[model samples]
Target: MNSRRATIADVAREAGVSPSTASVVFSGKTPVSDATRARVLDAAAALGYTGPDPLAASLRRGRSGIVGVLQRGPLGIAFTDPVQRTTMDGLADAVASVDASLLLLRPVPGGPAGDSGTAPGPATGAATLATVPLDAAVLIGTIPEAAADVAALRARGVPVVVIEGDAGEGVPRIGLDNHDAERCLAEHVRRLGHTDVAIVTLRSELNVTHDRLGGARDVFPDAPAFATLASSIDEGLRVGRQVFAAGRPTAVLAQSDLLAAGVIRAAEEAGLSVPGDVSVAGFDGVPVDGLAPYELTTMVQPAVEKGRAAGAAVVAMLLGEQPASVTFTSVFRAGNTTGPVPESRGVSPR
Candidate 1:
C-alpha cells in the first residue's frame, strides 16, 4: 500500500498467507507447512521479491549483528604485516565459525582535511568508524587522534578490543611482546660481541614520522644505529649504501628479514659477504622471499595463533564474558644471518 515497490505485504497478499508466514518463508524462523512455504516462495518469485529488508529485520531485532573493525593503515598493509594478517585470519575464522561478520571501518580522523567529521564522508568510516551502530568494535591498530571516536564507542556501551596496539582505557588488549622481542634481538647481536650495530625499522604508529629506531635508541641509547623507515628490504638497501659509503659494522641487526635480505644484497653489492664481511640479523621468523640457502637469525612469532586467540577472546566478549588481555611470545630462530663478529674489521662505520 505504501507505494514504492513490492514488499513482504504484497507477497503475502498474492500467496493468500499472513504477513508473518511470508516472513517465515524467507527467514525460516518458524516452521511453515511445505506446501505453504512453496506457495509463498512462488508468489515471491512472481513479485520479484528478493527477501525481507535486512535493515528492517535488524531494527526489529535491535541489533546490527556486525562487529566494527578499525584499522590505522591501508588494508594492503594488513597483508604485509604477518602478525596483522594472522590475527585477522583468526578473527575471520572465529566469526565464520560462529556465523557472524566483521564490518571494516577506517576513520580518517581529520575529516578528510583534519576538519573532524565536517565534510562529506563514506558511510563506513565516516559514521560507523566514528559513531555508527555496532554490537562491538575492534580497533585493529591504535589511533591516538581518534580519541573522540573511542570515547563515543565507550559512551554507547559498545565493547572494544585492541589488537597489537592500545585503545585508551577500559578496553581489552591483545598485544605482542614488542619490547621483549626487540630486546631479544638486541641481546642476540650484543652477545655476539657486536656493539657497533645499525637498525632498519618500521613505522612506529599512524603518524609515520616517529622514527622507530629513535624510539629504540631511547630504550638502548648506547646501541650504534642507522635507521630507516622503509620496509626491511628498503631499510637494508639504504643502510647498505650507508655501510658502503661510511664503513662496515661488525654486525647489523635489522628490524626485519625483508630488511636483512636487503642488507645482504647491499653487502654483496659492496663486495662484502654476509657472516664473512658483516654478520646480519633480522626480526620476524617467517621465511625470506628470495633467500634460497641462507636462514635468518630472527624472532618468530606465532602470528596466526595470536589472531585465533584474539578472535576467541572477541567471541567470549560477545557472550558477556569478562574482558581480559592476552600476550604472545616470540621464539628466536638461530639462522645463517648472524655469527661471531669478524675478527678483522677494516674500519668501524662512523
Candidate 2:
C-alpha cells in the first residue's frame, strides 16, 4: 500500500497546471475556464485527493477552532459531579456559537493539572498549553491551584478563563459568592439555636470548599471540618458516619447537597431524627438523586450561568478583548433538614 498521502502538487502534475492553479481551483478563490476546472477536478478524482488537509487549512486560517476545557482532578471523578457536567454542557453550547469545538482536557492520573497523555510525546507541566492546539482554555473548579497553569497557557498565547476559581490577574474569572452563600446557610442553622456544628469540605483543593468552610466557620468558629474525596452520596455517607462516630454535633454542614443527604442517612442510622435530634445543611442547592420529601437547606448557585460567562469570556479574549472578571451570587434556601436545637437529646454546645 502507498504510505504517502496525495498532495495538491500531485493533482497539479496530472492536470498539467501549477500547484497554485490546482489550489485555486479547489479553493474557488480565482475564476478558471470551464475546461481548466474540469481538468483539475478530473485529476483530483484520479489521484483520490478529497480536499486540502484540515490541519493545513486551520494553519492557514491561524486557528484550530478548538476551545480547551481543563477539568479539576481526574476525568472519571470530575464527570461524576453534576455541577461540573452541567458547566461543561453550557460551555459546549457557547463555543458552538463561534463554530469552535470544545476539547476536554484532564489531568494525567497523577501527573498534574493539564497533563494530558494525548500528545506528540511525554506530557510535561505545560504540555496542555504548549502541545494542544487551543485558541482558548477554560479552567473549571481549579481555583487556588491554577495560577501557574494559567501563566503557562498565557505565555503560549492561549486565552484563559476560569470558572469557580482564580488564576491570577488579567485572567477573566467566573466565580460564585461561595463564602457569603455558605455563611447564609450556616446562619440559618445558627438561628435555629444550633451552635455545635461539623463541616464537611470537599477533598483536595477547591476554592468553593475553602471559601464555603470559611463561611461556615464565620458562624461557628470552633466547628471541626471533614474532607470527602468526591461529591457523591457514598463518600458523604462514609464521612458522615465518621463525623457521627467522632461526636454527634447538633448540626452537620456539608459542602454539597449530596453530602448533606448522606449525612442525613448517617443521622438516621444513629437513631437521630433530622431537625428533631440533629440538623443538617448543604450547599449547591442541586437536587440529590434519591433525596426527597425533605427540601434541602442550601445555597442555590447559578452554576450553568457561571459556565456561560466563562465561555463568553473566552470568546471575548479570543477576539482581543479583555473582559473583566465576573462574580455571581447565590440565594439561600431553608428546608426540613434543620430546626431548633433538639430538646430531647439536649444537644450540648461544643
* Best by the lDDT measure: 2
Where is the poorest 10-residue window by lDDT in model 2? 113-122
Write one digit per residue (lDDT tens) for candidate 1, span 216-292.
45445665556566555766787768866676677776767787888888888888877776788777677667886
Q: What is the TM-score of each candidate against the true structure?
A: 0.78, 0.81
Superposed by TM-score, candidate 1 places the C-alpha of residue 246 at a distance from the truth, in angstroms, of 4.1
lDDT of 1 at 326: 84
lDDT of 2: 0.82
Q: How far is candidate 2 from the true structure (C-alpha RMSD, Å)?
A: 5.6
